[model samples]
Target: MSLYDEVGGAAAIDAAVDGFYGKVLADPLLSPLFASMDMTAMRRKQKMFFAAVFKGEANGADGYMRSAHKRLVDDGLIGDAHFDAVALHLQATLEDLSVPGHLVRQIMTAAAGLRNAVLNR
Candidate 1:
């Protein structure tokens, strides 16, 4: 099974995204970056992006992630600290959902692999 399927597919991913972003938006460090944005759309996009990533779908194309996050990098609003916080939120979300430990690690690894691109490093 794909990582997506192993993690319970779209519904699971969607739920995680919701929970993860709730934490993110509540975080002082991350909240400012999203203060002016439409969270509903952001959540939708994140769901699509992560679903694509775990499913190995073309929609998760490298350029999309890079481009999508480019403005944040350019504005100096995103860096290792922000990325780490996001990662933590994701980890916590998965854990809270009771995902298998090994699978959570795998998912986190995949997320970490994208840090450079996401941070525009």
Candidate 2:
């Protein structure tokens, strides 16, 4: 089965994204940067991200990196620490939901690839 099929598709990704942002916003270290925006849309984007990864494809996430954080990073509002916190939050959120081991590894590996694409500093 496709990893997306394995995890229950878009709905599962939605839950995971919601859980991740909840953890992030609740986190003292991570909440500040996200304070001004509605995280809902971002969570939707995250679900798309996960869905693509789980399906073993890359569909515009590269384009996303180009424009996605242009404003924030250009303003110097985000850096390595913030990225790491987000990664940690994602891991915890997935763990809390008991995502399967293989899927977890797939997500983590995909995240590592994106991390390279993300913070090019």
Distance (Å) between predicted and true CA of 57, model 1?
1.1
Candidate 1 wrong stretches, greater than 4 Å: none
Off by over 4 Å in 2: none
Q: Give TM per candidate.
A: 0.93, 0.85
lDDT tens per residue, model 1, 38-67: 999999998988888888885546677689
**Candidate 2, clashing residue pairs?**
none
Clashes of each: 0, 0
**Worst 10-residue stretch by lDDT in candidate 2?**
112-121
Model 1 quality (TM-score): 0.93
* Global lDDT scores for all candidate models: 0.89, 0.78
Q: Native-vs-model 2 lDDT?
A: 0.78
